[model samples]
Target chain A: MSELVDCRGLSCPEPVMLARQALQETGNGTVQVVVSNAVALDNVTRAANQMGWQVSVEEEGEEFKLSIKK
Target chain B: MRDRLSIIFAGAVVGLLAVILVLQGNPANMGFCVACFIRDIAGGLGLHRAGVVQFLRPEIIGLVLGAFVTALYVREFKSTGGSSPLMRFLLGMLMMTGALIFLGCPLRMILRLAGGDWNALVALPGYVLGVWFGTLFLKKGFTLGRSQVQTAVNGYAGPFIAAVLLILLVTAPAFIFFSEEGPGSMAAPLFLTLGAGLLVGILAQRTRLCTMGAIRDLILFKDYHLFLGFAAIFVVALVGNLFTGQFIPGFEDQPVAHVSSLWNFLGMTVVGFAAVLAGGCPMRQLILTGEGQSDALLTVFGMGTGAAFMHNFGLAGSPAGVSPAGQWIAIISLALLFIIGISNVNLHRKAKTKDYSKAS
Candidate 1:
């Protein structure tokens, strides 16, 4: 099962930082991260990638869906 | 005491802005709004193409050159470097985006209401609330970081750019950009506009005048030194409008304004918070750029880019009301600001670790 962390509407590093913390808290297989901005999505993906997690980014309107798997 | 020279300096600045508006045939109610004028310039340069609002206002160009000349005279001109410049640039963009959405900067909101634009009434409170929150963050120690002195080349950079713009203003290049039929299209004569800009530029530089700083200082330190200048602008503008028969009372159909109170308030709230964080309003930023502060220049560029985005995305307000897109951006922007504020604050520290270290 994938846990979701919705960070839509948060600006800049916050979205990515929150996703990292959530991932760490879950300490597990898969996590879904969502953000309202393209910049934030890129940050999330970059942060996830650094942690050696597999990630996919999907766009919905102005928001992004990032599915990360460990 | 001559230290009180700020009052006379600010008064002179107000008087200079008045002359520019009167000479330009702008709604006498309006004068020297960096945000509004820049919006008009964007419209003029065909950036946005918003009709009835395109004009290559000479006052803006004058502001830069004016400060440029004064900086040269006072020997206060020194170029400098800023840390996190790109981030500051982006912050400026967001700042402008928020200001345009509300149809005024913090300075113009007061001007708008002082000129009897009731829509501005809504914005005043929001501005206060936003500044209050910013002050809270400041109390908790949020800062963008310090600027370092740089090579003389950096100080001359903005002056060089301003000189080029001045050249463009004078030469009227055959390929010069201008709006065909928008607020950008409306304009006052070159000399009159520039003269006004120069006068205010000198006066502002002398006094360290800033509308946003005026209010911020008052709230943060209970200081009135700067607020006096702001109060003077309102008093002078109100009187000038009354004398010129420019004071029209109404929420609807006000020049360069909209009627949505909630968005108006929210828009300026964003501007106020951003201005506080950024350290000055648009006009103050211009002055700083003239003095060779590259960070302020970045902020100005950010504001210009933000204006472009606001127009392109239909996120700017009209006389009728705020755009739905603008409202969405406002909501998202506020949340983003909150997150930035909270996370960057560095609140939780092992007792011995010290939060002041982050601050210092």
Candidate 2:
């Protein structure tokens, strides 16, 4: 099962940080990180990629849900 | 896609909030200003001895606390420091000095323009030029170096200090300064200001909304992602100002604003250059400090102390016009920033070339 990290209404490094934590907890599995802003979306995506995770992003209303798999 | 929409939404929300705060009795065309608020806070702490500009602004306190709480809740709090702390401190001081000379920061520069203050038109281009100048150094590999992770307590200091300030604000201690009747004396209700600050803090934290970064990114990487957010704020605020009847075209007799276009341009140029060198705007520094970046905390402290010095030494501009001292300081700051930028870039390049030759 994929773990979810919701970072709605949060800012910048927070979303990236949360996504990182979720990825660590899930190890090699998939982790879904949801963020509300473009900056956070970009940051989280970059962080996930840096950690050697495959990243795919989906738009959900005014928020982004990124699915990362190691 | 979703992220872009969110930036727009955040911009609209912030625009609306700024208008609401102005209508609710904050300073005209002054709803959310980091540098001005920090100056006021310095006065409140008796750092500057400025009688009229003294006030313990709750919004600033709430901003730090809000970011701190959110960072803690999300488990993203990391205490770190040791990345050119002294340089960061000096940059912060220079940044604040320039901001005071212009009577606003980057955010207020935009807000001033949205409210029809034509003075900002001059400052805006100067700001871009300054950022562009800084980007030249950035391309040359100018860096403050990497930060080292430290104990959690290091991250909590800014928040703890903010909490204490909130308490002081609430208690109204006799020693703590409060404005008698000036820009500082005029404020919205405490709860409303705090709410606005908290909201902005949360949104800014989420969106990484930085005016300097917006310009820097656009210049360096041709990225408009963050720039869109600022554009949204300008458009939305323009509409809001129109509705609030705050749109007074032309620059004459603008509240708390002067008419010297040359100084306006130079002042913000100082701000833009220093802010770019420091890696963020004043608001961004405050947010980072809340998130446990000790370097940012020092920067904020530097800003506060610089504000005090600006006021005490008559280096800050006034409604009449830019002070003589302020004008001199702006020139000196630009020259100093240029020296810092050039020297740092050369040192880094030499170091890199040395390492490359050794490896070969």
Candidate 3:
């Protein structure tokens, strides 16, 4: 199972950094990040991609779940 | 489509308001300038003795009240703060200094651009560079730390003060100053200004409209969400200016603006850097204050204090251009921002991050 990083209600840059931290901890495994808003989702996706991860976002109600895998 | 339309609507309304306010008696192409308006409020309260820019702008009061009402209606108002309040306050002061030197905030920058002030173009690159610097800090884990839920009273302070200011504005008390002439004396009808403020405040709070965030998000996330709002304001304002015969292209003799290229660039650069560090633009800070964020409130307080300090000390810029002291303050603001940014960067990468949702 992949690690789940809950970033609900967090703003931009913070969510991006959290996703980066989770990715580093996994180190080539899968990581899932959940954010509350569109801005955070876009930011997290870009950050994960910059770190060489494949990202796919699933809308979960008002929150967005980002699945990032290396 | 709905979301985009809402943002566009918000921006277009703001653009239209600026034009209307200008035509109604506000300064030319300066229907809304948060930094300058806050400075005027400072003067109104006798915080400074600037003769030409003192009136407790009704629009300012209306914005805070409107945001206050909207946040409560939407069930989004919460009292939260305590993440480096003092640092945020200082950043707010520096942010004001930068904006005052530029003679406007980011919102005004967009308005000026729409009015065809090319000097804002020079400031644009500087603002972007400053935001890029801020993004570098974020990449290195720069955060002011998480805030905690504070008492409800803390949340009410901003709006409470705003309401009180509204009273003072209406009463026209003896202690308050009103400019006999100059930009301060120039204002749209009081009720009309207040109504526009309320409407824009609600829309801005609803859409999370922020000019500083527009540039920052573009650089950090390649996200055009906020930039769409930014573009809408520019486009709408340009059209309005053209229709109103207010679009005076070129850098010279712009209304309430000067032609110092270097200071214009650096002033906005300082504003952008400090705003990123403070977590929002000047207008965003006010909106957050209404939503009950004490950290943002302190920043707002700092901005007012900075305005007073700038005017009293003659550190503020005027149409004569930035004084030597104003130039020095802008440069020193950059140094201070660099120090604040570097020192706050957490070098240690926590394997498990702390709660950042509580972050501003």
- Select the stronger candidate by TM-score from 1 and 2: 2
In order, candidate lDDTs are 0.70, 0.81, 0.85
lDDT (10s digit) by residue, model 3, range B53-147 = 99999888878888889988986687878889899999999999999999999999999999999998988898888888888897787888766
Model 2, residue B5: C-alpha shift (Å): 1.5
* Runs of candidate 2 exceeding 4 Å displacement: A1-41, A44-70, B346-360
lDDT value, residue A64 of candidate 2? 74
**Considering only chain B, what TM-score does candidate 2 achieve?**
0.95
TM-score of each model, in listed order = 0.77, 0.83, 0.89
**Runs with alpha carbons beyond 4 Å of true place in candidate 1:** A1-70, B346-360
**Candidate 2: clashing pairs of residues:** A10-B206, A11-B205, A11-B206
Model 3: residues with Cα > 4 Å off, grouped in runs:
A1-11, A20-70, B350-360
Cα RMSD (angstroms) for every candidate in the order listed: 14.9, 8.2, 4.1
Error of 2 at A60 (Å): 28
lDDT of 2 by residue, B186-218 (tens): 899989999988887777777777889889878
- Of the candidates numbered 1 and 2, which has the greater DockQ value? 2
Interface root-mean-square deviation, each candidate: 14.9, 15.3, 4.9
lDDT of 3 by residue, A3-38 (tens): 477766545567766777788878997777877655
